[model samples]
Target: MTDATHRRPSRLPTRLLGACLALALLLAHQPARADDALMAGVHAFLYEQAQAHGEDVVIEVRPPSARLPACEAPQPFLTHASQPVLGRVSVGVRCGAEGRQVRYLQAEVGVIGDYPVAAREIAPGTAITADLLETRRGDLSRLPRQAVLDEAEVLGQVARRPLAAGSPLQAHQVQARALVERGQKVTVEAQGPSFRVTREGEALEPGGEGERVRVRFTNRELVTATVIGDARLAVDL
Candidate 1:
């Protein structure tokens, strides 16, 4: 067990000892089963799965109030793959070989880690710099779904709205600083395997890095390209 708590011993009857011995033999002959201790299996599954995002994980699985039938060959799965797996998560368990009987369990996946927060109040349109941000450690799952953990995603970005000091930075509150402006002359590059072409064009719209911009070439032809740098855009051939 990766983690555990000690509990005082309780008296057991002589007949129960024989039953425990038989159960131990059963487990020895079979593969590890989540059904042995339902919550234990769920925690193990979540901890292992959450390891991809962070090393330190704390999980809490809530058992249903109603008694559940013993599960044979229990297989656990995430109920909402598109939704956030942290905080409150729904996990589904398939009981028996055919997986016809399904049950859902609620869980909280708390990953302890440090995330960047605003060191000072940042006004709208302010470009983020390392000096303006500080790190705070806590349960990452308790943070906003769009919280920005990677400093690279925050630095040099323009804030879309005011952020208070010590506030957790989220993805929705920031935007890439505009790299190309309307009516600006831009270098348009179209590239393909083993070939590349560069042409001069005028941007018809303002855009940030990785953003799409419409441009008109000297030939009066229009094309949409992705902004890669200041006054630079690219289109895949």
Candidate 2:
């Protein structure tokens, strides 16, 4: 074989090897997967915010239907300034060497727990009871800001307004039920570090437990006392 014939056969293999290496390098420099980038961006944003708020929360990030362009660095942010990080919200994913490309996705965050709800229509001033309330597993972040998270919070509390059946109970919508009625006879107890004394008195206002009420003693003296229970008041001597 001549020198030209030997060179020709080796040239084909050399070209083939060079092509394979170029292809590999091209792929290696390419951006990361769109779903993975988006997910990482969103999760990091949400996780940091949740940690800052001291909330033990689970964040579920939904991938965008449209594939995002490859990016060197991805950053996620809220779509709206007032949009809360909790519940159903939209997040914007930005990618670029210095924040050039941008995209958006939807996500949900929830505090996994059982929350209280009204089992029946509750009238204003009606005291909440076990039979009138129910518990449901839900994302606490999706609920209202004042939503009651525990059954104990709503029980024994009176509704401040008309509550629809199946509606979530809120902390601001309930108050402790009145334990002492207006003009009712009550036993006023005066207690201190040294001694305790009990006397008969009349309630001048309706109040719940731990609430302040005025009482008129048999001696025609008015004293401010804290309602302790049904027809009962406690005064510090």
Clash counts for the predictions, in order? 0, 0
lDDT of 2 at 34: 53
* Candidate 1 accuracy as lDDT: 0.87
Q: What stretches of model 2 exceed 4 Å from their correct place?
A: 1-56, 59-109
lDDT of 2 by residue, 1-237 (tens): 656534434355778989999999877654445577668778888878655333678888887776446655787888876654677878887788778788778888766667778898999989899999887876678789667766887788999999999999888899988999999999999888888899999899999999999999889999999998899899976
Top-lDDT structure, candidate number? 1
Question: Candidate 1: deviation at residue 165, Å?
Answer: 0.8
lDDT by residue (144-218, candidate 1, tens digit) is 999987778889999999999999999999999999999999999988888889999999999999999999998
Task: Predict model 2's lDDT versus the native.
Answer: 0.81
Which parts of model 1 are misplaced by more than 4 Å?
Answer: 1-38, 51-56, 64-75, 82-84, 94-103
Measured with C-alpha atoms, the lDDT of residue 113 in candidate 1 is: 82
Best by TM-score: 1
lDDT (Cα atoms) of all candidates against the true structure = 0.87, 0.81
